[model samples]
Target: MTIGSNSPTRQGQLSVLLAVCLAALILPLSFSGAAMATHTIGQELGGTAAAMNWITNSFMLTFGGFLMTAGALSDVFGRKRIFISGVVLFALASLGLSVAPSLGILNGLRAVQGLAAAAALAGGSAALAQEFEGHARTRAFSMIGTTFGVGLAFGPILSGFLIESFGWRSIFLSGTLVGSLSLLIAIPRMTESKNPDAAGFDWFGAATFTAMLSLLTFALIEGPANGWTSAYVLTLLFGAAAALIGFVALENRVRQPLLDLSLFRYARFVGVQVLPIATTYSYVVLLILLPLRFVGIEGYDEIEAGLLMLALSAPMLVVPLLAATLARRIAAGMLAGTGLLIAAAGLFYLSRIEIGADTMALVPPLLLIGIGAGMPWGLMDGLSVTLVPKEQAGMATGIFNTTKVAGEGITLAMVNAILAAFAASALQQAISGKFNGDEIGAAARHLATGDLARAAHLLPGISPETLAATYGTAFDALIYVLIAITLLAAAVVFGLLDNAKPSEEEANPVVSPGE
Candidate 1:
């Protein structure tokens, strides 16, 4: 059924479409709010550092792994049917999360939450595409894009308020309320849409791809903690490589592949795809790392940290809308590349800040980061689907989001590993000739959590100044690492994204034969 066709029931399409887009907004709300509440959850659950990381990673891994398969399922079944199912599943998982008894159960429920999210996002985006056309479709997507930025921009603050007043469980409970409302609206107003000639499911391809992401994440998160050369770590790494190779081969041979390998031929599309990965590697890294630094070292509460985070996210609300407006007048590739360059500059500025720098000192760099983040956030999603045929919208949206969450999970895990190693190295270097092994070991454990007072207790003979300096050195090292990676990613973006404007045909969704 074409969008806006004069059918008896089509009058409600606008409300149903907006409801789906708003449901997409709920995703980042939960994820980002969880990020803000991670420390509290860990303390309450008596979870170790590694277990805490798993709370987020487990969800991301399954979300990314199941995205394509879910999108394909929607294509075969019906968008409305799959979309509603996803909402119900997501709501149930969130409700379960609010009352989880242990860290293990919470992690399991998070994975279930991610799977449901995959189904909801894929089906929702596909439905929106079917419900709107051309300029109207772009505007609908723009609203979705704006919701995405605003949700992320405000998530930490919202989560902080809820966690402060009601506890972290309220975050999940809030998501459940929103999900139920979406399901209610979607059931009656939403029309069912699917590809009439959708191909059969490629189960082998899906399995191999899922294995690849899962094994790769397992290796990255576990390797540093378990000793990189340990048998289990090495096995996971090699298994991931094998799974990746198997997935590629299977996709190439399959009649109906999970991913269309041919899509990579569009240099612009490849360039657009890379932006999310780069943004997560750089911008989201700060989202995860900065809160820890603020709370652990700077002596701030969760509420204060969230307020500080607002400095980093606030520009996201305005800049994406601005960037979206600019896209019509400028080439998208250049705009995205420029945005990355600005973000790299922001990262460099952050690296220059002293370890004892107060929250006030962070505002300028945070604003820069937010603006840079918004620029690409504005264009990448719309550009991703525009480059492909409308028939492939579901798959494209799936891959697009999978890259985002997977990149975020993988990069955050890597950063955690880096922080642990660097902090230890800095601690040892600071006390090289001045402390005994027992004292040093105690200091190192305290330093791992950025606890200067306790670490100083272990080194009673040392001056408070020396202990403070040692912690500062470790914090500075992380900033330097982030700076280096952001710069490298910017250079990659500049070299890869094409500066030429796409033609009208390339920019619009193709009317597939079935349509």
Candidate 2:
């Protein structure tokens, strides 16, 4: 691609891209790796079910909350300043995570990692906007998204090897090495820039918005554990609701808003936002879900589970890039919509396979889902960049990423809660009144996470065979919901995003080799 050409400007451009992409890998690698590492971490750290959930949740809460604020800060302060600071902090945090003495300390470090990740991601992305133009910008943003997919594709395998060979701390060790390299590459080569017209920080919007997401996630994650109708969960839900209303009101009144609520007026932007939420259920949830099922229920060991995930996620290596290339000629909306329907079909295929089914039974559907998810995943960052004016790149990408990451975080929590409920119901019916609701819910929650040891511990009297069957039944039902979500997203994305192409006058010509 023209991005890697030897001209001095091109060389500098490539350096910026490389640094950002490398930094981009840390989030997905840590996230997908942590999901697979849950049991191993618990074995050493004495994790409770709640603590196990927080392994991912704690990171995402801060990550999702701080993204927009970080982006706006990048635009206000120098992007290079924020970017390098974030990278350095991220490296230090990873080093701390490797030797943390307990789950509490480990989770605290993860939260700090999320805060640093937000700064690194927001600052670096905005900086790259200063370096590229037109089609180059499109490709640059797509590369970032693809880099993340690549991390997701390989994270489980890497974590499994690191954990089995050197223990869980090595996962954090691996991240530290990567962060150090990202910081090194970025320090000398990356340019510093910011929006001249951008105003002071929107503290009210920031505080209210972050508070809303933090409260909502807490409610969702705790609802099942505390009982949905429990006073504790209900109060959290109320606080989250109030915070949301306050956030909306505050955003409308603020001069320089953290979120700029007016952006939703664009049909294309709305369509673009939908893409991430849709993929969360269709693709991201599976990253957490499949590992649990394979390792916990199917009797696959950690490495085997990671290998099985390879079939589901390896298309990140090729398919997303293919989708981006295809977007040049085809309507991107049509491409995304068609791909999601393919995913819905794949989910349906997956729903039929029984427990302990052979690899061939699983591989085909997983591949289809990976291929389907690849299309929308590839389109996100590019569309986000194009929709807003270049000056607001920090805010635009920040909001887009916040939506993407926040959606995944909330959706993961919701999917787990829903699956636990569905599995609990299935367990109750399958066993013909052997257990009460509390017992069933406890077992289902653990089983849903693929913590077979805990699930068994929760239901000492229940046969392992019965628990496995119950989980299998719940998985089928959950897949049905995912299928509906994908299909709905397909239609909605197409309807809103079709005919969203730029006018010929605004379109840039593809660059030629001689130039």
lDDT of 2 by residue, 1-515 (tens): 35755666887788889999999998898888888887778778987677788888888888888888899999999899999988898889989999999999999999999999999999999998888877778889889988998898899898888878898899988889999999888899998898899878888888888888898999999988899899999998899899999989988988888888878876678888999988888999999889878877888878888888988889888887888888877878888888898888888989988888897789999999998998888887787777777788899889998998888889988988889899888888886577678887888888877777778887778778888888999999999999998899999998987754322102622212211
Against the correct fold, how does model 2 do in TM-score?
0.96
CA lDDT of 157 in candidate 2? 92
Q: How displaced is residue 84 in candidate 2, in Å?
A: 1.4
**Which candidate number maximizes lDDT?**
2
Stretches off by above 4 angstroms in model 2 are 1-7, 501-515
lDDT of 1 by residue, 401-513 (tens): 77777777777677766766666577678768777654675565445444555667777777656765666666667767766766666665566554533334245444232
Q: Candidate 1, TM-score vs. the true structure?
A: 0.90
Pairs of residues clashing in candidate 2: none
User: What is candidate 2's local distance difference test score?
Assistant: 0.85
| lDDT for 420 (candidate 2) | 86
